[model samples]
Target: MKRREAREKAIQTLFQLENTELSVDEAITYITEEPTNSFYELLVRGTVQNQEAIDNTLTGSLENWSLDRLPKIERTVLRLAVFELLYNEDVPDRVVLNEAIELCKTFGDEKSGRFVNGVLSKLTKK
Candidate 1:
């Protein structure tokens, strides 16, 4: 699978965790069984290991939009993108931002793409 596809799967997995009270190991196992490439595993591991920090940063970034207020899909996508932007030095910031916008277009509401862009842009500045 392509990196974008893997990232999408990771986003879905993270979103599932957000909705449920599943343990991180349980969530990782659930997502890993899906038919995805190696990149998916890496993203899942990275996101799981850093989820708390990621959520804290995300919550701080959204001045008016609380993390829970955003649509689930949008929240997951943004978390994944923000993780990449803030921690994954291998991925370019532009690529992270673009992939996030694509994810919003694919799985989020009509306004989500712009909302993600705005939040990510703010994150990049910090």
Candidate 2:
């Protein structure tokens, strides 16, 4: 799958993992009918493995809003984006940010894009 598609799938898988008791493998299997690409697995696993650190980073970057208070989609999008920002050195920061905002627009509410942009902008600056 393309990177964008992988990202969307990663978000969905992560969403499922958060809301349910599914293991990473189970979540991945539940989300896709076919095999997943390396990038997709990297995202879902990396985000899960590094979640505490990612959430700490997010907690620091977030404004008045705490991490848990945000909607699930928004939180999931941020976690996926932040994981990429922290771990994927090959991808450009601008691309990660733009893609994340777009994902928010597609999967989250109207303001989700802007909210992601604001949080990620802070991360990029540091």
Candidate 3:
């Protein structure tokens, strides 16, 4: 799978893990078993391990919107995209934003793509 596809799968897996009470190890096992590109295993693992810190950073960056108030799919996309933006220096911010927007378009509500883009744009400025 391409990097974009891998990122999308990672976002979906992360969303699944977030909605469930699964342990990180269990979540990782489940996610990796799915058909995905090899490039994303480490990325997914890192994102899961650092999720709390990522969420905290996102919460701080969001202006009027608390993380809880956002839809779950949107929050999950932001978490994955922000992790890439803040922690993965090798990935360009534009790529992160684009992939996040794509994920929103695929998995989120009609307005979520633009919403994700707006939030990520704000985050990059910070």
Candidate 4:
């Protein structure tokens, strides 16, 4: 699968893991039959492993909103993007930001894209 697809799957997996007690493997299996995409696995596992630090990084970038207060889709998108920004040096910051916005647009409400962009733009600037 493409990185975009992997990111989408990762977001879904992370979203599930956050709301339920599913393990990483269970989340992956639930999301896809061909779970062999290394990039996808890396995204889910890496994000889960580094979530506290990711959340900490996010805490500063949020303007008036706390991480816990954001909608689940937005929160998951931010966490996935933050994980890529901090851990995956292979992808550019712009790509991560754009992908995050796209994820929000796809999975969240009308305002989700701009909300994610606003938050991620601050992180990219810093």
All candidates' lDDT scores?
0.82, 0.95, 0.83, 0.91
Tens-digit lDDT track for model 3 on 64-84? 999999999999889888888
- Candidate 1: list runs displaced more than 4 Å: 23-36
- Candidate 1 lDDT by residue in tens digits, 1-126: 789878877887788888899986687678767555667777777777787898899988898878878888887888788778777899999999999999888888669999999989888889
Question: In candidate 4, which residue pairs get closer than 3 Å at backbone N, Cα or C atoms, i.e. clash?
Answer: none
Weakest ten-residue segment in model 3 by summed lDDT: 34-43
lDDT of 2 by residue, 38-110 (tens): 9999999999999999999999999999999999999999999999999989799999999999999899877
RMSD of each: 2.1, 0.6, 1.9, 0.9
- lDDT, residue 68, candidate 2: 92
RMSD in Å for model 2? 0.6
Q: Least lDDT summed over 10 consecutive residues: which range in candidate 4?
A: 27-36
Q: Clashing residue pairs in candidate 1, if any?
A: none
In terms of lDDT, the poorest run of 10 residues in model 1 is 31-40
Model 4 misplacement above 4 A = none
* Model 4 C-alpha RMSD to native: 0.9
Per-candidate clashes come to 0, 0, 0, 0
Best by lDDT: 2
Q: Which lDDT tens digits does candidate 4 get at residues 73-124?
A: 9999999999999999999999998899889888997699899898889998
lDDT of 3: 0.83
Best by TM-score: 2
